[model samples]
Target chain A: MTSRLTVVYGVRASASEIKARAQAIAVEQSVEMPLSAIHDGSILSDIVGQVRAIDDRGNGAFDVTIDLAAATIGSDAGQLINMLFGNTSLHDDVVLSSAILPSEMLSAFGGPSHGLSGLRERVGAKGRAMTCSALKPQGLGAEDLGKLAFELTMGGLDFIKDDHGLADQSYSPFVDRVRVCAAAVRKASERTGHPTRYAPSLSGSYTDMERQLGLAREEGLDVALIAPMLAGPSNFSALRRNHPDFAFLAHPTMTGARVSPVLFAQLFRLFGADASIFPNYGGRFGYSLLTCKAIAAGLLGSFGGLAASVPAPAGGMSLDRTPELLDCYGEDVMLLIGGGLLSAPRERLAAEAGRFVRAVADHCYPRLSTP
Target chain B: MTSRLTVVYGVRASASEIKARAQAIAVEQSVEMPLSAIHDGSILSDIVGQVRAIDDRGNGAFDVTIDLAAATIGSDAGQLINMLFGNTSLHDDVVLSSAILPSEMLSAFGGPSHGLSGLRERVGAKGRAMTCSALKPQGLGAEDLGKLAFELTMGGLDFIKDDHGLADQSYSPFVDRVRVCAAAVRKASERTGHPTRYAPSLSGSYTDMERQLGLAREEGLDVALIAPMLAGPSNFSALRRNHPDFAFLAHPTMTGARVSPVLFAQLFRLFGADASIFPNYGGRFGYSLLTCKAIAAGLLGSFGGLAASVPAPAGGMSLDRTPELLDCYGEDVMLLIGGGLLSAPRERLAAEAGRFVRAVADHCYPRLSTP
Candidate 1:
């Protein structure tokens, strides 16, 4: 029985006291702890394991590892993790900094089945940081955006996607926008002999979302751009599990709930985001550099037996920041440059994006060829 | 366009500074206010009207409001409100305490379409305080829970529901469980001529959820219990819209993300919960009495402009505290008592619940009934 071990560390509380409390909690909720001398024959024993760990931050949060002997988590591993967080929520001073779960739980629900490696394989980007662009300034028509996509792929971006706000609005209906943009990207890819994947934004009423997915499929779009917060986290996992072949590029609309300095990074990865885009440290939206670094570590670092994920930092980024970002993020990162590139001249769009990608590649892996 | 006004109250910041920031956001994102005089316009203005009220909360949080004119909230009122909330979210420190909107949004979302009046009319308990009981001791079999439900309904609980944790575990497959329980309650109702309604827990995977609801409908259950956090907030609205005939009872499972003293209550109502169940003050959970009062007040109290909703206080509630709870939360409240009742003897279960309800009813509205 592979279990979740959450190591808690704090002060004003002894390990013995914490252990007693943990055992009590286990008995009160899950299986009873047999090791406790205080254990009575009255309650059912449900606890399978527990242990304490050191916290470098010296924060009041206790790091406790909980062992599950059975398949307590059904299909939705994310929800199960949420329940765990909820259970310990009665205490305020106690912070849940991290959670470790087995890969089986993720595999049980088909979590990130294609991850970064598989996605890169499909996109045919074997090495080097991939350049991605977003078609934005929402008020534009589908044809106008499609023309921009043509130039962007022609310029050098390996991937292009719709901005998170690009819902099925009158400015650009989802199906029409998807058809035009995907075709343009495909034409550019064919001419250049490089696969430039197009991911269209997906957000709407239930029927509308289903229609958007269907239309994307019909148009042969490579990835479906979805904001997990807008479409619901479970919705992303649900869609991904259902359409295993379609690459899920999750956006971050209305994602304020998950960005607290303490819990943001780990929770996002736990919810099964293959690639999560957060407003960078120095970016306009205000996530601290420390927070960004933690998010990167949480996603790419080995923990809970889950596979690594891509941490995409966007929002108010520019070409000059490419080296700095790549230097910080390393090779596994996805450099998403949106409005900054789009605001430039049409011809400069692709060239600037290509330049930015080349700079990142040169900075991260200097041995790799620029072409 | 009855636009949304988001009031963010925090430490005193310059009004011009705040307004400038708001205007910058409006232009950069939505309506496009020029950088020089960006403070003049707001996101709401694009839709309708704008009013920025900034107040210092002594704490670091600032209180600001953006009032939208009626034109902004056109035919798609529900979406209009969502857009309002979404737009303001792009900024920070805007702890949304209230949302002011016209009746059209309520109608569009079919809010408590059948509110307290309609609910009372259906249950045939118009005047007296309603009685409800949750069948629990989570690990029990379906037949055992159904038998308990039968006893409760027969012994005179107005409503019988499954404890929120009673989802589709192998011990109690939802379809078979709902069928047996609904039948048991129906038999009890037939015998006693008491119109006791049953609402079973229905939090499952997307497909399982749809199937569970279909089964609940087939089994003639009056209401379906849904934990918005465990499921999704949109799921509640979508379910209500899809199953117009059925009533939804929303629970606060794994909903701690929004339970901050500032935002929890009002947002729950806006997220479309007819009866929003939260942890009561002085329970095993740790919400302050003031916070609980605020939640209740926010639910029933008139805000900038929002509909009244039922504040359901559950989670580790005991009968001894019923009188105190009733005193704190006046009438028009649903007091959900779970584990305490489950601990009672089978014979005493219904009578104990009825006694508890009678005590609350008597304490709150003495003229109505007494045990």
Candidate 2:
């Protein structure tokens, strides 16, 4: 039977010692190993298996994988995998790496409730590149931010997301912000005969989260951005089950502390995010280039059962870096440039973003493909 | 005028560089300072003045404090404190020390609805020390664990708690386990008249948490144990509002990740915990004796017209160490002995627990000044 894998990185200890610690954590968090299992030197024989790997940098980092018992991890295997990482964090220097769990792998979301083709179809972009930007820096009044968002949509950006920091602050209350931004986007779309979608940040208590979702629906907003850790685990499952019509764009905030370099993609995809936005390789955060590529690959990789999620490489994304990111992450991607687009003059932002997106598409898919 | 204090530890860097980084995090997480604040050097000046003290522990550990702007924190000051620590964590070796925000502390949960004297009155332990122990080592079945709890209660322990690891699992399903244990504790209490109360672990989804609380109430359980972080921020407040009659005992499970030598007592005390349980000094957890003492002092310290909370010291506690812990924490504390009690023979566990409790009482109120 194929089992879920968990890769942990830690200081270089004796192989036996590392194995013992790993087994202890697995038993402590999942199934407890009996005395006989230990005596037989198969303490984790039923629940997990051992793998060999080491960190070359030598800053006390080693990589080891454990095979998860199907019983230990129930139907919600994604959450089980996350719990493995979370529980192991009780120890020192154990960062989560990659995970291979059972789930649908083709559709954009776990099973792409809407894949790239579907999303592009909805946006009326068959084979062309799409430019996205964020309504940023937070603390701005709803009216001010909404106006900026309208200008950007009119200017030609395909997507406009509220900055990850823009939660339910009073300065820009979620309801008012979503209403204003949605109206602006719609107005721009009507004026330009071009469509633009808005994804507002959803980070609040369960009740407040519901209010935000309801407000987005009322205002006819295209997508709702969410950060699971910030919102809480049940919120996502509840939103998916109850509010099936609401499109979700998941942001990585307060989440990196758990998954780190390894199991991020699998967890995010399984969490049921349509498009998972993560910090890029050369960004303000800590994810490495190889790890970033792995995230994209894992998201697009073959999953026997799990749904696929679109990898949105964000953070410190600039026009100059578009080609590099696109080359690394294939055509099935979303280039989220937030602050960089905002800093430029309003007139230049849309054209600059559009040019960068075209360049990325051309470079990644040399032959003339779709839009 | 009391400012929030945050302690950050980092490798030796110029004061200017550290100042810049600290200021940046403050602005990023908190209220954004105006250019005037940055230009007049008021932002940096404020940080400098707010820093009550700085202690550099040569071995890459440093403690520094900052007076936070109240406006930056918003209505939820505790969240602001968490944000302060969360932001600083991106930088290496930075630990949050103590946070002393504006007084309005207990206004949140109205302090401990029932404190030491109240509990004593309710349990009718006017002259005796309260005995307590946790059901532990995890791995055991629910029925078996319930049987042990019965023995401990019959042995005259005042309180029985589930080990922090005891969550909703298949082996010991939460509701069934709670029903059996609560019933057992009741039977034991009836036979002994010691009024042993059971507090089961309440850590999970919001809906499930409500179900757990409801089950506890239906089963005639006295208190509900919670780990706030694992549950979420709004959990305590919601619990208090929904089940005003129930007593909430917050546990420290996913919290050590935040407060190990970083933030100090002031912040945790006011953040909605009526009886905050932390790892004792010289325990397996590595917190210093001084830090433990500080936690106690902070919890019991008066905060802005709010009543004090009982500090419960736990983890790696033993019967032998009871006298020392009692002497250090005094009578107002709740002594939590877990594995030590579990390891003892069933026949002697209660008396051993009672002996430890009596010793604490003898150390604290010796004779009650019968004049």
Candidate 3:
């Protein structure tokens, strides 16, 4: 197996032009010049990406693996990205199916400064799948949402994150919200005697986010709800790398460009996501069952010895789907249900939370009784 | 006429399921639940996105304008993004064509910290199209690429940037490269009396990049070539907003998911980009003439009264296409040719630089003589 493999996966719907598209991706990504010029076999031949193997998965879909010369990516995440999906992403027909990062690159990125095990221990939801929810609708005041989070965690959630839409606004600034919410969760933990953490949204410009991260940490927040697409993957990865204590959960907002759930999950982990959230198969967003499973598999799979991160499948999940998700994902999953829970009667939130936790608990170990 | 309006752009490619898709976008984006469940029609309707108008753009493509409630986005940049493309981006068929941010959102998320006028003044290219090139083919040592950059700047290119492929690699460590390259350009600028600037690639995790930015500033570098997708758009925007003195040049790497150039340019500018570069028509990359033109138009077009940004067309641009580019883009354009100049014989570099600038000068203002 090649140490550096760049998988050129184009969409099945546009597979008629697969070979040409694959070749285009190779040249466009690397040399940014025509391939024919290298026919004379100069240094450019080795420097440019060359398609080594092609596999047709039938049904109009094909996977072409290109062997990128190790020197193609200049040891930085940004350059690696330029060579991966830079220009190709503009084309609707082509989709980046997958790529194997050089072990050195994987080591440099160091997938999720803290992975699944760390998070499982932090939230104290060991021996079963994790549970999380969002303080949502974007416009809630800090106090209102903090109280709501207090109630939910009191009902028993491992970690409560801010919805991707929740950012620093007049109604609820980031520092205020994070501080208030963290206090609420801490108070709830004291009452319930079950540890629950708050992962506030760190969504802003670098300085803005840096301050937010500092505040969250100062207030003893455990994880950060990072919008990788909105924030920039490198920024999040770097922050995660630097701050090893806090855990991270990725939110899927404006990440449609990474079409495949598997690629989405794999890249997120490689870049530094301890927990990546994806749309559930039968839910509102259009991901299929196979793709969702693929995302879960890739997240927990060994990649050049990189640690396995948690795959959190969200978007339109409810209490009823907990059993199915538990069976599918086993223990390495973080179930996120936003509107599914937020839309329920405010009074019934505690009851709903109890049922959700019980379902996951019962499914994880059917041989044993629920707590 | 509302203070906040979210423009909905959908594809003709998936028109068979138009209404359903439109409704899905409205629900998935805001509520993330079945619309029918909001039977009480209480505050949920006010909180959710409401589709106001839908138009058929000739073929199967249609434009649907949805007005999200004013409080949809918190004041922070991430919330705006979540409201814009978020979950809908997962659906391949749904393309975000164009969006309009309300005045308040626009005010909160200021477009470009510095615009066209600021750049022209800084570069001293007072009245014509600016010329720029990359120190590329990543494997070269810091001194080699730095000398190459010095020669290019001495030859008269306005802005010398690191190729997207050039990162903090062993081959050319970022600090070593930035210091050497900036020194080379500074030395050349002293000799030529030309105000050339070196924009190093700030491509690493947060701390890694923060150090690079500080180093570039200390070394008297004017701008930094930032990969928004790689660093996270929010990260770049934050860096740009905080460090207003250093100009930012946006590079298109790992940004293929943003399908439409028009929408791509609009969003980049909205977030914060002094200059936006895209693959040109007839380039090694597959952007069509129409798409490239649309990208240019969008950057220069007045949206929400934002200052105009420079639209740079790059990728496989040869010396021959100079006049046509001048005609198409007129004055406000940054013609970026990477390998076109770098691939030339070392001895001929000075002449090549002169001719490249001369062509743009002659086209922009025929009476002006090439210096």
Instruction: Count clashing residue pairs per candidate.
Output: 35, 27, 9
Worst 10 residues of 2 chain B by lDDT: B31-40
Of 2 and 3, the candidate ranking higher by DockQ:
3
At residue B354, candidate 2 shows an lDDT of 65
Instruction: Supply candidate 1's per-residue lDDT for A285.
Output: 65
Per-residue lDDT, model 3, residue A360, is 77
Using lDDT as the measure, the top candidate is 3
Write one digit per residue (lDDT tens) for candidate 2, span B225-248.
766555555545556556766666
What is the per-residue lDDT of model 3 for residues B1-371, given as tens digits with 9 covering 90 to 100? 33556676665545576777677677666655555544334335566677777787867777877777656664555566677777777776677767767777666667777777777888878679988988776556788777788789877888888887777766678889998999999998888888987888887765677788999989987688887777776677677777888778887776655546677677778777888988889876667888888888888887677777789899879888999988777788889877788766777776787788788777844345769
Mark the regions of model 3 whose C-alpha exceeds 4 Å error after superposition.
A1-3, A11-20, A34-46, A57-61, A71-75, A364-371, B12-17, B31-46, B57-60, B257-259, B364-371
Model with the higher lDDT, candidate 1 or 3: 3
What are the lDDT scores of the predictions, listed in order? 0.61, 0.61, 0.75
TM-score of chain A of each: 0.77, 0.83, 0.91
TM-scores for all candidates? 0.82, 0.83, 0.90
lDDT of 2 by residue, A240-323 (tens): 545767667776554535345335555656656767777788875566888788878766676655556677888767778877
Ranking by TM-score: 3, 2, 1
Instruction: Give per-residue CA lDDT, model 1, range B1-371, as digits (tens).
Output: 32343433232346446665544443333432223322223323343224466555554445655554333333332234234444334344443444555555444444554545555666776545455668764445689879888888776666777876566656667877898999999998899887888988776544556778889888887587776545555555677667767766766654433235324445556555566677778775678899888788777776434456677787667778777776677667777776666666677777776777567556745344658
Model 1 lDDT per residue over A1-371, tens place: 23443433232246456665555444333321123322223223333334444433334345444443233344553345434444444344343444455566545544455567766776666666667888865556699889889988886676788876566655577778999998998888888787888988776444456677888888887577766544545666677666766776665554443234234344445555666666687876667888788877776777555656667787778778888887777777788888667767776776776776578657745345678
